[model samples]
Target chain A: AQSVTQLDSHVSVSEGTPVLLRCNYSSSYSPSLFWYVQHPNKGLQLLLKYTSAATLVKGINGFEAEFKKSETSFHLTKPSAHMSDAAEYFCVVSDRVLTGGGNKLTFGTGTQLKVEL
Target chain B: GAGVSQTPSNKVTEKGKYVELRCDPISGHTALYWYRQSLGQGPEFLIYFQGTGAADDSGLPNDRFFAVRPEGSVSTLKIQRTERGDSAVYLCASTPGGSRTQYTDTQYFGPGTRLTVL
Candidate 1:
């Protein structure tokens, strides 16, 4: 079984300050991890993803996450938080590879990032 | 290019009624997914379709909840004897599949349909 746990339910940070949202996982196989953002009344947008190739993944809007196997974590980080970064963030994990073209995702509960000015 | 699209952005219905939600995935995308998000929670996978066939339907909550992708590009999630527990924002996502890498199947989500079962 594979599962993802986000450490924080809500995180508040001032604009221009650093941001960190923590996530840990339990997967039998090496996992495919991703971060997604959702604004109020909007759809989810992929922030970044970690496949087998990369450990440190950079995403749009200056957000990034490191896939650390030792820590059992893939924590999203941004050097400078923007007001626009305020939204609900989700950390996701995929259970298995596609026998042919498998691309399934299981999501964590989510963290609400509140950026204050 | 246009992203995935779902119809009837909001639907309010009485309990015990039947409702259908629709999705039109990205052009040329071979894989589509349906998920439901309740208040204050992450989206839960309902089902996923590969091409015109359902590759997985295990996530569906109960027999009353069903989905179909008959022609491959479009899908409909049907709920029979709708329950109040079914009220939530139903999301649709699609990926251009053919590989296992997340890049090959990075899901593009639609705005979602807000279904209210009263």
Candidate 2:
């Protein structure tokens, strides 16, 4: 089974400070990882994805995640946090489909980011 | 260019009633997925549809939960004998499946339908 675990349920950071959200995964095969953000009552927005091609993946809104296969980790990071960055973040792993189509995503218990001024 | 869209933005139903949630995927997307999200947890996959057929339904909780994508563009999730535990946000997403030329298989999500079973 492929699964992802978000280390923090909530993270608070002041504006202009650095931000980091940690995630760990367990997978039987090489995994495709992703980070998605959700605002209140809104749809999920894809921030970034790691597809084995790149160890360091850059995403929308200045967010990035580095996939470390040795550690089974894909941690999201941002150098400077903005107030608008306050949202819930989810770490997802793709479980391979046996029928040779798109894989189903396994999501982590989200992390709520609170950006303060 | 429209993103995925789900109908009945909010639904309030009584226990033991039946309900149907609809999803209209983005134009030309070949894959559609349904998920259920609780108050604080991430979305849980319920089913996956490729074209007009369900490629995977293993995530469905029980026999009362059923879904169909007859036309390959729109999908409907039907739940029978709904319980209070089924009260949650039902989300739909779509992606370009099995496209080798595409760099990423990212799924685009809809705003989601909030279901409340009282």
Candidate 3:
């Protein structure tokens, strides 16, 4: 019974400004968390993932997220927002380890980031 | 080094009709997955295949949804009696190995096939 909840359905930010997309999760055991970005008409691209090794995970395009166990959160952040950064972002959790779901991914509803220039 | 690919980028059919969506995983990938994504929603898991066998199909919504990875490389997701509710983007993903390996944690996604049931 692992799930992810993205706090915001849509977020708008000015170019070069800081950006933040919040996500929370509920899992019974240690969980694997991931961030994926999807551009229009394109496939999902892996942004970053948090395993047991790292709490502050850095991803491509200068994006990063911090895995907070106590807060039950994994929030994605970026220092500067570029036009290319505007896309749909998903917070995902793995279900294989605990639920025997064979590496299935449970995704949040997703947050659409709009970068305003 | 092509990424995972899916056929018929878009499909339109009438309700009660059947449809088949295909996926071609990355060359060396041993695990394939199927997911359905509705508008403005995250993709929902449908099934997982490991080397030609479906290791997990519990996520399938109903018996009308079925999938098969015949040769461990290609997979076909068959939907029977399609309904308007089934209209959504069907995404396919693949990973290099099974859950036993660390690399398997990352699932590469395809562009997805948008299905519209009229």
List per-model TM-scores for chain B: 0.96, 0.95, 0.95
DockQ for each numbered candidate: 0.54, 0.58, 0.56
Full-model lDDT for every candidate: 0.90, 0.92, 0.90
Q: What is the full ranking by lDDT, best candidate first?
A: 2, 3, 1
Please provide, for model 2 over A45-116, each residue's C-alpha lDDT reduced to its tens digit, 9 standing for 90 to 100: 999998889799999989999999899999999999999999999999985763546578899999999999
- B72 Cα displacement, candidate 2 (Å): 0.6
Write down the RMSD of all candidates, one decimal each. 1.5, 1.5, 1.6
| CA lDDT, candidate 2, residue B53 | 91
**lDDT, residue A29, candidate 3:** 73
> Model 3: per-residue lDDT, tens digit, A1-117?
889999999999999999999999998878889999999999999999988787999999999999999999999999999999999999998745413335778999999999998
Residue A39 lDDT in model 2?
Answer: 98
Q: Which candidate has the highest lDDT of all?
A: 2
| Pairs clashing within candidate 1 | A98-A102
* TM-score between candidate 3 and the true structure: 0.96
- TM-score of each prediction: 0.96, 0.97, 0.96
Ranked candidates (TM-score, high to low) = 2, 3, 1
For candidate 3 chain B, the 10 contiguous residues with the lowest summed lDDT are: B96-105
Encode model 1's per-residue lDDT on A8-117: one tens digit a residue. 99999999999999999999987889999999989999999888787899999999999999999999999999999999999999866543455667889999999998
